[model samples]
Structure formats: structure tokens, C-alpha cells
Target: MNRLIVTGASSGIGLAIARRFRRDDWSVINISRRPCPEPGVTNIPCDLAQPGAADGLADALSPWLLDRPRLCLVHNASIMQSNRVDTLGSADLRATLELNLVAPNAINRIVIPHLPPGSSILYIGSTLAEKAVPGVAGYVIAKHGLVGMMRATCQDLAGRGIHTCMICPGFTDTEQLRNLIGDNAGTLAAITGLSAFDRLIAPEEIADAVAFAAAAPVLNGALIHANLGQRER
Candidate 1:
């Protein structure tokens, strides 16, 4: 059976991806603080933000290293803070980059060696990755770094039949979005209006994009925008 390792699979878009893959009969490994509770999904409790947290991923996955099947690595967990550059602390900025960029890169180094020829890496980015928005300086910069990392990885592994792609979503409806918007209902309204549909992007829709990228080998190294035309880049 094909195997998938998804970070931040406890909820939101991550959880949806976990469910989607499990339904397709792939062996799903979930890395997150909370358990997925979905039948057949193995939850490995982890906090990606902590120092050296990603270093252990390979050992946790060692048993499956030799399973000898198609493999996929998905980086879906992230932290977003709303603060202007002048107000963002160095500590906060470091932590954001650690989780959003460093952890995923470490996981890539660990898992890439064991990935079979058809393996793929999926980096979940955001609209902020391409364009800056007010009050989210760290997130925007880190996401931009992630896109660069994804593209670099794609180039590095392209000759080995390994695929890497960045999927950028726009204001997806999820727990993270709720927290990002806080109790300010108007902020949510304003974000939704950025898309032509005038609604928040669905986690399921992002999951579908995930499925599409995973199945299409020709899309290797592609930067796919699933944001419904929120911003053209």
C-alpha cells in the first residue's frame, strides 16, 4: 500500500487530507499534538514548533522505510500571528520560521533518502506566500521561504523521479483561519470578499487540490494556486 506522512493532521485542512488519503486506502501517518480519531489513521503526537522536534521523524518512520511502496510527505501545519513588522518580536519571528519552514525542511532531509522513485513532497503555503498583507509579516516571510524551499527541493530531486509542489490556499475555512480572524467578524467578511466567490476557501477544496497534485506526475515542481483568483501572481 502507498504510505503518507502528514504533519498537523489533527484538524482543519490537515485532517481533511488525512481522511481523504485514508479513504483511498493509503496507510496514513499523522503527526500532530492531538489525535485524528479517524479510523485507520495513526496519530503520532508531536509539536513541530519545539526545537529539534523534526529530527525524530525519520526514526518514527523507520519501520516503514523499507515498506517498498510509493511514499508522500505533506507539510500542512503552520502558525500565523497578526502583528506588524515593527511590533513582531524576534522570538516570535524565529518560532514562526522554525515551525513553518525549518521543521518541514528537516523532515524533507530525513525522508527524502528513503523515498522511492515515485515519491512526492507537498508543501502547503498560502496567499501570503506570494503577496504581503498587513499585520502578518513573519508568516508572509516564512511562507515565501517555504515556496523557495519547495522549488529548490523539486529541482534537486527532479532527476530522481521525485516530485515536489507548493499548494497555496487563500483564506481557507479552518480552525487556524478562525483564530487568525479572532472575534472580529468584519475581518472575516473582508477576507472572503477577496475571492470572486465571495466565500472562504473550503478545506475540502484544498484537499481536492492535494489529490490532484498527488496523482499527476507531470506536475512535479509546480507552484499551484488554489486561491480562486484572490490575487494573481
Candidate 2:
């Protein structure tokens, strides 16, 4: 079976992806700050929002390294603070980058060597990378950085038989989204109104896209948009 490490697996899209992978009998290493209750999902609790957290996570999972020849790394952990740059503090900026960009990059750097020659790395991204979402500057910046990282990884890993792909999704119905919008009903309404679909994309739909990318052997350096035509690339 294929072995995959998925960050942010405690809830939302991450949890959904983990569940789907487990159901497919893939060995799943679920990394998150909180523990998930899903059976067959190996929990690796680590805060991806800390500078040193990624290294710690890499060390923790080292012993469980698979004997197989392929390792799929899915980076889905991110923290968002919806506020303009003028209103946001240094701490907010650091927190957002640490979770959304820095830590994932660090984790990939440390873990890349352990992945077999033909392994693949999947970066979860957002449509905000291309469009200006008013209140989420930091998030947009980080995701944009992630896109660059994915492309660079694809180039660097090409000769090694390793591939990189970015999976960008529009607004999805997930626990994290619920938390973000529950506090501001009007903002949520405005966001939905901006969407041509008038509804949040399902987490399962995102998970399916991820699985498809993981299994597609020839999809190296591909940016798979799962936004239902919300933001075109």
C-alpha cells in the first residue's frame, strides 16, 4: 500500500482526506495539533504553527518510515487571520506564515530525502493566491509562496523521479470554515454571494481531487484547480 503523510488532519479538509486515504487502505500518517478519532489513521500530533514544529514532526515520523518505494506528502495545515495588514500585528503575520508556509516548507525539506525516488509531494493551495481577498493578505501571500515552492520542487525533484503538484480549492464546507464564518455571519454571507455557485464546495470533493492527483502518475508539476470554476487559472 502507498504511504502518505498528511498535515492538518485533525479536522476539515485534512480529516476528510485522511479518512478517504485510510478507507483506500493506504498507510496514513495524520499530523495535527489535535488528535483525530478516525481508525486506521496513525496520529502524529504536532503544531505546524511553530518554527521548530516541522522538524519535530519529521523526527517523530522517522521511525515509521515505510519500506516501500513511494511516499506522498500532503501539506494541508494552515492558520488564517482575516484582517488587513494595517490592523494585523507582527504575531499574526508570523503565525500565519509559520503554519501556512514556513513549517510546511521546512517539513518538506527535512522529509524529502526519506521519500523514495519516485515519490510525490502535494501542496494544498487556495484561489486567493491569484485574487485579492480583502481581509486575508497574509494567507494570500503564503499560498502564493506555496505555489512557487511547488513549482520549484517539481523542477528540483524531476531527475529524482519525484513530482510536485499544487491542489487549489475554493471555499469548502469544513469545520475550519465554519469556525471562521460563524463569528461573522455577514462576512460569510458576503463570501457566499461572491461565489458564482452560491454554496461552499464540499470537503469530500476536495478530498477526491487530492486522491486523483496522488494516483495520477504522469501529473508531475501540475496545478490541479478544484474550485468548480470559481477562480480560473
Best by TM-score: 1
lDDT tens digits by residue: candidate 1, 84-203: 898889999999998999899888888888888888899999878888978889999999999899889987887888888989998899998898779998988888888888898889
Clashes of each: 0, 0
Off by over 4 Å in 2: 183-186, 231-233
lDDT of 2 by residue, 10-47 (tens): 88889889888888888888888897677888898888
Residue 82, candidate 2: how far off, in angstroms?
A: 1.6
**What clash pairs does model 1 have?**
none
* Sliding window of 10 residues with minimal summed lDDT for model 2: 224-233
In lDDT terms, which candidate is top? 1
Q: How many backbone clashes can be found in candidate 1?
A: 0
| Overall lDDT per candidate, in order of appearance | 0.87, 0.82
Cα lDDT for residue 181, candidate 1: 77
